[model samples]
Target: MRVVTATNAVKDERQAGGLVVEVIETTSLGDRSYLVSDGEVAVVIDPQRDVDRVIAVAGRLGVRIALVLDTHVHNDYVSGGLELARLTGAEYGLAAADEVPFERRPLADGDVVQLSPRMRVRALATPGHTFHHLSYALEGAEGPVGVFTGGSLLFGTTGRTDLLGQQHSEELARHQHASAQKLASMLPDGAQIWPTHGFGSFCSATQATGDSATLGEQKWINPALTLAEGDFVEQTLAGLDAYPAYYAHMGVQNTTGPEPLDLREPVRAEPEELRSRLDHGEWVVDLRSRKAYVVSHLAGTVSLGLDGPMVTWLGWMIDWGAPITLLGESREEVGAAQRELARIGIDKFAGAAAGTPEELAADRSQLRSTPTATFSDLAAALAGDSDGFPAPEVVLDVRTNKEFAASHITGAVHIPLYELKDRLGEAPAGAVWVHCGSGYRATAATSLLEAAGRTVVLVDDTFDAAAAAGVPMTEPGESSSSS
Candidate 1:
């Protein structure tokens, strides 16, 4: 199940010996950065590209920033570690073996950095997510409080080993298994487990559930702790799936030093200019909710709503450094998208506009709409009920392969969202009806299909509704159903 937390950014001040570990969650990206403090001194771990949040937390707690560290050269988002350290004049450290162009305090396994008389951090080599990954063990006057397991040992799963390459995936899986064993052997059962990935991060081998966990708790549930090394390696490798294509750029950005964040509002784009940009094949993304965009939006503008994984989808599909123009109902929406984009190293924007579709479009002709429906509506359409809309010629399932394999509408064409850009033409010719696990991914696919001049309907409802709606369902290897 997808872990749904109430808020994206939350803090957990529970720590031993007056230490405060503030969890700075980037819910949009399914990752967390930490601001661990011992009353007067603070240290940050795996910070995002926007370092302002970390700085604000430190200021609120009235702690002097003593050090900033990266658990690993991140593969999901640009690391804000260097910038945060530079801004605060704190020691910036990473695994010593990671070759980079910038200067950094190199840390080796078993190395300890004194934060205060009562608090210090110990580095342990745990190479699963990356070759030089490190997990920091935070020690206090009482003893070990917790360990910052970047991507090594997550709450219930370990980080995927295939991010490096398929050739090294199994090899890395072995190291990952060994690393988790090492951590379990060294740390006590009560030690809190603070991981940077696995909340919902694609870096995780599987979707991890749980907001907080102790080593004791994980021992029973975490695959890394429960399975034998050989079994763990096989299970982890088998469970891997496609991650966002934007992940290809994140590691390089982190290692080479990411560009300084730029969240400044872009120059406003007039209606004519927005039309010209769209005509020329530039990305004009509408930041409105899919529910709103499907009803009415500028023709050709794709719906990557600020309400969903906008950055991940936009970054994955758009050409790197493409001239992106954001359209939202208000400046606040545009501003929010800008910060989220910046987190993934999308620093350049062609322009931006904030207004309703009617306000942004030069003429009513420029606005277009795609029909939206729920599973019941689709079921009626399939049954040829005159009260429902026309029967769709095609039903497109745009969820991941694993999601489709588990259970999906019978006879629906399967095309994973990430692969849609390259395989658009492969979609069968007809008025298409599309759905995903939820409406989020389907909306993205619907926008793409509409932009490609295909007649499409967005199934904007939960997958659970399909069975109840009498929509025929089947899994892999099952007999074919009528299209």
Candidate 2:
């Protein structure tokens, strides 16, 4: 077996058993899009936002993209399956039970998608990451060659099960454990494992250090794979991070499909056009890093730094149903930002603002800035009930379930920011107060709640402020109703 990393700067490839598997790593999300072929036909797995990358790679390799499969309905990035399939006239596939909007071939457990005489994919139903999660085992001349794990099995940890629902945790954990054991038992020791998400991914606690690892290595070192079923469940549930607020929207977008956005011809908007859209309720998503955003940003733009998990945050913070205009430092930056957001299924881009700062600045009414709250000011607000502050019952903790369970303000309703949309109806209509572990997520929650026609007071202070103010604190894993 030999591996050759594709050098196009946009695609990656490795060869085994005379089969070439090209991986298109999205610059926007770090999510990998794969093209597996044995020269004549190809199968793409979890393609990123851009179809051009896959099309170009397939053209270069002299192969056709015959089938497109999404491991599951993605929450962090949009799947390019629909776009790629439409462009190439390939069959799109989803797990048999998946209820996505597009036409798809139903892939079931043990079903094989044959690419060529020497290459094929055996679909393994590995639910729990998402209800319809599927992992693919690549069989080549070398036998069971590699496995595309998607988000079900990461390098060290497994996918967070809490994203689906709190009530589903125990059942999900049980299924996740079963899936891990099933994969472990079936895959050969030397079979390589490739995952869609890597480091810096919010989906996994930790990604594999290298791009790919072996099943044998995972058996010995992967915590989720190595632990007893019950322990695996406990550790995964315990180490869970706060689910990003954008996850729910991303799920719906992935299932329903995003409207196509063409990347080849950059859609440049004039300053007046940008302002008009903003006036009409379109949001300006500034996709620069936090430092760049802080230094300067278009007025009234929400910053989901390009350097961080921008797409994930964008899907969480921005209204998926709303139109978005992008502002980046350069054309490449804008395209990259667009690709990242597209991965999570947000394709409703009106256009990108083009030209020099001076050109954009000529229209003063068009530009606004992000509001910044100091740590001290946030602390002051949390410490004492200022004039007109709402009562304790009105306070809402908008952090993740894990974060709220870890520590939270007394009498605050526990509403993980990701679940805010579904749970918002449960919140009392008047004077709802919200806070997160820090000010960032809280600000995002406040913005959404405000947009929903609810009056919200944002608590941007640190957790210690609650303690200093004699507000009772509940440790994580304790019932919110407990004192």
| Residues forming the 10-long window of minimal summed lDDT in candidate 2 | 368-377
RMSD of 1: 2.7
Model 1 lowest lDDT segment of ten? 1-10
Let me know the TM-score candidate 2 reaches against the reference structure. Answer: 0.71
**Candidate 1 residue-wise lDDT at 261:** 87
lDDT of 1 by residue, 235-316 (tens): 9999888888888989999999987887889999999999899888789999999889888998888889998889888988
Per-residue lDDT, model 1, residue 322, is: 82
TM-score of each model, paired residue for residue: 0.96, 0.71
Each model's lDDT: 0.88, 0.70
Candidate 2 lDDT, 256-348, residue by residue in tens: 876675555347887777667655656766665544544444555555556655676666655556778787777788877766665665555
Error of 2 at 40 (Å): 3.3
Give the runs in model 1 whose Cα sits over 4 Å from its true position: 1-15, 386-388, 481-483
